[model samples]
Target: MGSTMFIELHAFSAGSHIRGTHIEASLIGLKRHALTNRYKMQTSINCARNSDKSYHEQHKVANLILPYPIEREEFCLCVFTTKHHISQHPQRGDRRSVLNDSQPDKNHKHRHLYFDEATITVSGGQGGDGEAWQTSKTKTVKNFKYKWGTNSQKFIELPAAEPADGGRGGNVYIRVDRACDSLLHIHKRKFWRAKKGYHGSSAPHSTPGRERPRLALTQEDLYISVPAGTVVRRKRSGELIADLTSHGMAILVAEGGAGGIAARPSQQMYSRRQKKEKEVSDVGLEISPRVTTSGEPGEVVTLQLLMRVVADIGIVGLPNAGKSSILKAITRATPDIASYPFTTLMPNLGVIHCERIVSEKLIDIDHETCALPVIADLPGLIKGAHKGRGLGRAFLRHLRRTRAMLIVVDASGQDPVSDYTTIREELRLYNPEYILRPHILALNKIDFEWAALRVQEIKAEVQSLEESAVGPAPIAVLPVSAVSGSGMDILISELMEAMRLCDEELSIVRGSAMDSRDKSDSI
Candidate 1:
């Protein structure tokens, strides 16, 4: 006996969003329904009677099919941002996490990053075959009205109608439900592909003689649910994916196939009525990340989040520079105050309430936005940061987006002057524009016993460079004790002054450029 059709599961592509709920809009012009009660009853009985069981034993035994399997025809919305390159392998390998191009992380690894419980590839159903039949009956013998006396013959012939294409394969879908949290569904599967078309019948046959059911190709839809503010990113290029701000917004990725040729109608049935079954228009795929209310950052998946635009002043220096300690003293925000480098990954924001003397001037208001700003604790830059050594470019990129830069140098380091130059050079390499931003030098750790002597030497060196160079090396070299909370007020004041000066210079440049343009136009 021929075996029942064995269903195959397709792997949804990475970054494809699968929905947990059904999409009513895409179902238009298609027949989507569960089996009738009686049909379902018979199917359950037959399934239970069968002794041989396979992977889908429970689902088959119950005859509980999904009413609308293709929830949304779209998956993989980020595909447009990705640059495609032809390759022999069907699966894609990510270069950032895995070094080797040949190895792809198991599909289930990034489940936490997606919005839906599953991501799957959908295929269309196969069409049924057609059949042909004929009948021959004659009464003759050149007799009168009573032909019963004459000889009569009758025969029937039937033509073979080829089977219509297998009902196109069922489309794949990714479903997200309230019970799920991560994208654990994709882990179990590899890739998703639609079902192939079935062959046509050998001969013409009507309804009863037809061997298969009439199946219009139906596309499989995939859906996923991720956290709100979850950024969807293109896998290969490491670019920002979708910023899923809304709950139900879906993005389309891939489309399904068109239907094959239809059967011919008979000429003899002049008065017969005919109906046309709509073909499977297309299949769609989309990968969307869900937006969640949780403030906690989501797990790292394909992309990296660099908090640049969010923060203003980034506190950076050598180990033991007291960057974290200073941050605690300035703002109520609690960053671990330890004499160590790499203390903070997330930036801390603080409000610097202006003192009586500072708040009196109009310029002070302008300084507030630029000077007293949200500070970020960036990983310290070592000698080789420009070349991407020791969290090099990553740290620098974070600083690049800041309006101003702050160098928290160690007062007791062997060479504070050299440290400042090293940092400036690295910044220049990362972005030449960084040099244009107003920056200051803060000699921290002044409470250390040896810091007095070191602070003097460093201040002299910086002052001497200021005299020799056309412009100042930095506005001033202020000594600060992060432990004792000393010199913070003065440092804040200096930052305000520098911001005011920078703003004035910017205004002057804009005015001069505009004036020059007017002069040219007049001439």
Candidate 2:
């Protein structure tokens, strides 16, 4: 419900003694001054009036309930009520706020906001203006009074304005929020502006001659929250500014302007009785007292935000290749799966714990949560994917930060080897760096007799091709049926091992690069 108003007053105040008779004023302004501000609206109020004096025959106080609209009469009495869905303060939640309550699922209502790229404008707040004092030779104060004999008192005039300095403006920053899994929250918003600074003010008990020392209140800074792995870039120049990869990482996007100062008066005195060297020159810099500095403008920037999902392993395959099914079987991800292509438009992420080999068997380690393999089920790719066919470019970028790839192929397809080659070629054309990452082959749909018959042939061909490859070779080839869960245990172990090796290689590369940079800096 919208805001409702409340009003309570006496009808005697509405019209004071008209023809020496009191008339009830229904929603009209009170004639008598409200000493306690009781006339102020609580929420909002609606009043109905009966101008005729016939309704004023009863001179008794009554409690009025609104909404019936049955002609309310008397001194104005107003009250308001609101629904729970309506927030009292939108900027912050109150005790009655339902924002913290469990939300109802409206299937894919905000799916459009899950885009990978977005353009936005961000700005920082302007700084406050500095304070100043009036010029005077001596302290301006009231003189004491003598009470005895002929009592006399002297009073000094005080300025009308308050003596205080303006507060500083807030700065804008980009912070990574772990709860934000996507750019959905900020994608729809086109412009972001921080609050401006306060105007100039003076200190308390300050006079034209002297200013009291005091601490100024600082302003709060503004922070725009985005998901981890969001890359902030300048829209016009395409310059990379910040890359927030991990949670709790943040960067300053714009700096607030510095506050300005007001003109303070200074005295100039010269004496001829002093020596020539002691004589002071009257020529000096001077600022006019009428000058009052205003706040500086905030920084405004148009930015392009690109988000790449950071996962340990990425699943790549053609449309209708059972990638989602394989991911579902491995972890607890319930992705949209169908025989048709492009079923999984947005990427889906699932986590699987790392295991250690004990007694020649896989054992889950409870404390290995830090480096658990996070599997990403990306949207399927098609022919000419690198040429922007089937939204492949957007899907391919999700693999940029992954440690390894899990390529799933439909074993029932006419040519499993050709499909595997097509996927590899697409990755190579999109980015050669992707080929350098470890890759695993999972021949899906092996439960069918016809597909199972050709699984060994496909596996052998893929291994032979991998042996001929340069750096990015297929780590292992395994035939598994997502529907029947055949060979899933061994397939999972191989994928885990491949992910571990890939992570170690990446860490070594990063460490070597850091060492080289250090050496250069020392030189």
Candidate 3:
């Protein structure tokens, strides 16, 4: 009967029939099969249900369904067994694949941005304390007594000794190191202090009185490392402390205090007793030594560290003015190059070696000499830069240290003349003395079709401004193509010459000042 029922159920499930007669026959066969294996079927159904629930909880299955008993028990058993096997034996490669899928692409990149300014508090170490001590001696005689009675000698107290000197406080020093690239190190540290000196020890045999040994006299100095081209100034007074332009340069920021002096010796002294005594006596004494003074405290000061790029020539221009392109063409610096504006957020430095041949007529010996000048490609400046516009006064300070400036203008841009004037006015407004520095006007992108006309108009406008005394006279105007390397040689030569002339003029002024000072000193 069971065999017949199983065959009938299989036939019903195999064929797709939704008729009432087929349904009734399948239900009857399912009831007969359950009765034949009542205990086994109940256990299998419970196990399947538990497996399904466990699988859903562990694997997070979105939607799951169990087949009807009459349809096919084998299908339901296979599905649940497969899920259980997977749960027990997960593949190693599957986990790795999942992790890889969750991570971002390896080609993704990031940049580390650094600040140029920071404020920090620095202090020197405090001095050590002084100590004091004293010594004492006692003597007794066992000689014959007088007619009156026997007596004993009293305890004698010795004079107190001077205390040792205290140790000197430590000093704080700021040093410039080339290994540091930015002010990031000092920015993280808000306060710095030096180690204090050790205290002095008291002398032996000294009484516990108002005297003690002076503190140990030694000074400890703290050295702070900073990047080259850092300018340190007082935070409160705004006083300029030092300008560290070269590597290994250092300055004393805070000075340690002097050590305390030892205590003076006591005036009173006790001598041995000469008279003899027949009676015996006991003498006991105690003395307390005290420290004279403690060392003075070191200086505490707040300082501001400002970093500026050290370069001989600074390139200034508007966005997309080909400044970075020219820097790349002239030197080996690799600045970010893109058609978009503000591509360069930080300053890039490059070295330009200018070679010159001296003729015998001009100089006694003819030789080729090279002047290696550092060039800085600064961030682009926009209108109202002085008023804190795009990349505003943050970068303007970099120009202050430059000996010469190169104003790169986009000849292809509309109204190149206006661009030049705007940049000049912004510089003048930011610092009136900046206008006095020698500068070269570089009309870039001369390969453009209308660039020639724009160059001509810019030159005319510059001339008119000079005639009207609107600004200082520029060194010269040179047309150059950063893309094609056109007029680059002329631009370099002019920059070198301008730097040379400025140096000569500076030397002459320094010489005159020294001569006047000597004459006045002699008088």
What TM-score would each prediction reach against the true structure? 0.44, 0.66, 0.60
Writing each residue's lDDT as its tens digit, candidate 1 over 361-438 gives: 423464435545656666667777889876666556656545565678887788888777777777767777776677
Best by TM-score: 2
Q: Which has the higher TM-score value, candidate number 1 or candidate number 2?
A: 2
User: Which is superior by lDDT, 1 or 2?
Assistant: 2
Clashes of each: 74, 17, 23
Off by over 4 Å in 2: 1-114, 131-162, 202-216, 263-290, 353-370, 466-471, 507-523
State the lDDT of candidate 2 residue by residue for 1-523, as single tens digits. Answer: 3344333333232212111011123223222322224444432333323343334233211122132111224334323232111122212222122221222211123352356677778877787765654521233457566454565656555554332345567778889998887776664345666776664553334444553332135567888888878999999999999999999998888776655444333221111112211332355434344453455677888888889999989999999999999889878779888988888888998876333233346644445453557899998988898888887687788898998899999999989898988888888889888887888889999888999999888877876776334345688888899899887778778877886687688799999999999999999
77-162: candidate 3 lDDT, tens digit per residue: 11111111111011211111111122221111212134577788888887765553332122233434433443533433454344
Q: Which stretches of candidate 1 lie over 4 Å from their true place?
A: 1-307, 349-372, 466-472, 520-523
- Locate the minimum summed-lDDT window of 10 residues in model 3: 269-278
